[model samples]
Target: MDAVEIKGPAAAFGPRHEDINEDANRFGDRYSIRFVGKDKVCTNLKYKDKHSSVSKDVSKEWCDGCPERDGCAYFEPFNQIKNKTRSLTAPHNYLEIFPDILDQWGDIEVVLIDETPWYNIFEKTARIGAHDISHTRSALRKLDDEDKADSDVIKRALSLLDTLSAGLSDKDGGERQADRAYELATSIDFDELTTELTKIHDGRVLEGTDYTDAIVAIADNLTEIKQTARWASDQGIIGEFDSPPEQLWGVDNSTKDNAKFELRWRNVDLMEIARQKPVFVLATEMPTESVEAMFDLPVVTVEDTVTPEAEIIQLNSRMAGITRLRKRNQTFDNLVEFTRSLFGSRLLVR
Candidate 1:
């Protein structure tokens, strides 16, 4: 033989103990097989040409040309077998031998071939239709909800106006003052004020207009009631006063100084009304503890952990794949198709 070749399981079999004795019994110490018809046998066997096989070896050419190429137990099946397998895989049919291609060539470049430009044009038209439908539906729903809420709010405001009008029916006050009070109370902006005030009161006991002249009136009435009740209690006319009589008027002098003390307390009440303005309770009630705790939580840093070598390699590989895909010549249709593959039908609409 021009070249000594091992076949079947003998290719993997190394020198055995019996081989040493056989070699010793042979004519020469280094024994070799010489087949005279080997050249003729190789010529008779079907083999791939040098250009097709890309190999100088006859065995490699023969293997490449063999009719039972896929039936070989050691290697992957032929392209026909792979194509059949891909047909059964569904959706991602082209990925069957992709890994093998990548292993051989380091990476496989996927070229998106768009033969029909009309598909892209149709897809864009469909996407615009979908977007318009989605937007119109969303807007309609939002407007409907807003209209319902606005109607309810208007009804409640109108009801409040009727109540205010009834409350002032007997009051002998200037119409201008009442008008100003009504304007301030009934204003839509006052809703925010009442909402804030209710938060402070821990409930919705006060209406938007209640904080205006109504609150001042209630406070004045409460002070007068408390004072009268206290006086009656002092002369043994009613229940005993919880606090001292002098504290009510801030008077600590004798009965001779009572009139002066009364005037001073009256002035104090007026001053309290002028200086102590009410604020929204809700705005002031925000939890400081939870906010402070949020600030006190631990922070993450880049130095806490390092990327693994394997992960870095995988990232690099993916980046290379992306770069290769980007460099490939692709039509607009290809991009649309790829995007559709990634996010499904929503990709085009979005």
Candidate 2:
């Protein structure tokens, strides 16, 4: 670990143990497993892959502005919109930032995650329908003019509507929790919505608006109401959507998700690997924030505890910049060999 400092193969905890499975990685003694979190298991034996099984619940609202609104899946229309947009993420962007790292490493590459994407069996599915936040806003403004809203509950709800309206105006997703707050405001109590609407002679909220019915229909189902709030908050989704479906069924054939659950998730019984074990640990090199200065913990300077045959790596103020580390193709064996060459023969197992 000392060589990780002064010389720099800059190491960090990489993927969680759950990231690997029989299909994604090799098993047996060469690998070490570290189990975490809950131990739930599931299987897919009789679930057939059939488009027929997916009966589109006739949610017409999602189709309103979609170019292929006639009959389209959420992902289908989304793919078209997505192609028109681009982002500077990961490998490509980083390569541009540090072009010389490519030259220096000579095609040596350090890997991040495996290529296969895994899906959770219990995936959340948003209902597709037409939604108009502006209409909802109108309904809210109507409530602001009501005489019955003098109560504390009604007052707080109106205040929340104001906050939500301000938040919806902000297009920046990183602006605290404003977007989610706006979504929640859209799904608030029906009485507020009713007040905002132009009521008929019989005191009904306006009926022509696509989302008006759902507001009144789901007023009492608290669980569905919360789910509706979640669906609204998902920025990728638009339209008046209902609560998430009871279940979303999809089969993942990749080795990553369809692997033997027991083998993929097992406890780490040992903290120290045996010297004779032929195993290598993979870690990421992340350039984290540097402390301009620090005091020794407990106000006591701790002396080095390893043998002199071990040479320690030093990380300090001088090596705090982004250039201090770069993703490169490196092996633990190379680190062990380099350490031995410089500080005599000491094993790299810890």
Candidate 3:
């Protein structure tokens, strides 16, 4: 881990994991937080991609208008994170921030998962409706009229919208039609469009005006579709979109005029991406069988010897799944009373 000194809000933990401190990363007597630099602290993808070498302005741009800025105590006027920090304090959703973690970190030596990483890895689905595209086109026109957004960028985006409208036309098989749309989606100059739209969004957010909403909506939709295409292509199952066949993509034709397109990827080999590093998951409750099923890997359980003072109870009853417990109020009330009688005011029903 690159060890660098960081100051101000740029060094603070993100909102969800702010409770964490240097103590949480203590390995024996050594603290790992000292290695976590600015790139890891900032969730901005643009900054993380370049590591510490990325411009400080990237972090400033995000923090300047961040909704979470007001709640953080370490807020600083400038970002102090440096590139290639040796250690990182990442959240449960670090995969979202560092999708290419293995590439950047080069085969993780060890990972102490605070909880189960049993969630879906790379599988995702994104959709947008025809009307949403229509609204985006109109919004872009409005922005152009007001000189609030770049006319060239707006024009290109509007043209892409037209391409999507044409691509979505029902003229062939579902797979062929979807492929046509996906091709159009992937052909976008994503970096250029995203950067321009993000600038507009940052400015618009400050003004409390959602003039960029429709444009943002379409951009988000296309980004998702592009991601789905990449993952599907990587797995060599791009054309197999049918659920029974491969579950990669789908078209929602329920609405005649406002049809939606959904794209999905079933699974990704988490270990393959991690370079087969040993993953030690810590959890209060985790199903080994579930983990094995999703990851296709063997799991060994290690139970703590220290026992809790609280009495443990397990109920094997279908009554909890009953459709309407209200109809059997007496039965439910009796169970509650029995528990309350045993525990007094300490009983908590959740």
Candidate 4:
């Protein structure tokens, strides 16, 4: 008899084809933003002296789903890491400066390097990827009386969202980050989210967080479900399989050509960003280290504060597009400066 070999148990595969979109920016001007969001690793939670989530209110009027809802009503979760203050990973916090960008460049092409997939996940959850204020805010409008009136929890959550949205409605209000985060949190069908995806999602740690893990769980496992349903329809002929197929778990299949059932929202956002690549990207958080090894362009690090600044690639008929990159050694002084640097020092705000 011949010996037989078998494969390991089925799990999420890898080598995902990331960033299918074309690159808009040329070489030599690309810059990477480090430590952009407010998270535990970025903020030294073990050390109490440098914490920024400090507030006397000690109330949770803000949605518990919000990272900043910890000790006060300030938007964006405050992260303390070894005596460092981290800002919110909320894309809205980063995008609030868009009006200024529009005022300064007046429709200039730009790219925002989103360092983490969480931002993308939030946006896809409700077509509010990158924290597009209007779409995210509108998610609340869809809530029926069951969500608003019957559920006190949802009512409070929505109230906080309304308040934050109003504050950021006109100018970049102080509470916009909080409001934007709320929008992102509410974007997903929390009830449907699966534990696998939620575990990796940064926001899942937040208390009272909504879940959409269940929604994509069955859908991603469509093949397996179909098989089961088909068998049921065919009068139960095949009981050969013991468990649900690997397609069900929509988690950690990072490799390219990895086919698994994915949530519709994530796919939507991914394609949208791919189509509209901006030249200069201002990222709120630092991207994964794998970014350098995987991509064609190098990540250039700049020593600046406030906002993430990159060279604007000029589209000239005669000259080829240019790209510049920096090292990861440089550092920005404060969170405010680094965040502001994304907007750059320029003209009008209108």
- Cα lDDT tens digits, model 1, 1-350, are 11122121110111223222232233231222111112222332333122121112434555567675554432332342333321111011122223343233321112111121211111110011122223323332343455532544434443433433432342432233333433433344334323332232221111111112222222223344355445446535445764323222221223331211110111112112111211011111113322112122221111113446322223356456655555554633465665455421111110
Model 2 pairs whose backbones collide: 2-313, 6-313, 6-314, 61-130, 109-329, 129-240, 130-240, 131-239, 131-240, 139-196
- Report the Cα RMSD per candidate: 40.8, 21.1, 15.8, 22.5
Error of model 1, residue 126, in angstroms: 68
Which sequence of candidate numbers ranks them by lDDT, best first?
3, 4, 2, 1
> lDDT per residue, candidate 3, 244-307, as tens digits?
2214444566566655655443344444432334444554244455444434565555555546
What TM-score does candidate 2 get on C-alpha atoms?
0.22
Candidate 4 local lDDT, 1-350, one digit each (tens): 01111121110111112221122111111211122222332332332221222121212312334353455322321223112321111232234233332233322233334333333322221111113223223343333332432244334444544443443333432233433433434443434223323232223223333332222232243344444324323433234433322221122133333212222221222223212322223332434322222122343444335445743333566443222112222322343455575443211110
Q: How many residue pairs clash in each candidate?
A: 1, 10, 7, 57
User: For residues 181-241, could you state the per-residue lDDT of candidate 2 as single tens digits?
Assistant: 3345455554644433424211221122233322222232334434433433342232444
Q: Runs in model 4 with CA error above 4 Å? A: 1-32, 35-37, 41-266, 274-350
- Model 4 worst lDDT run, 10 consecutive residues: 6-15
lDDT of each: 0.27, 0.28, 0.45, 0.29
Off by over 4 Å in 1: 1-167, 171-195, 198-213, 216-224, 229-350
TM-score for each model: 0.12, 0.22, 0.37, 0.21
| Candidate No. with top lDDT | 3
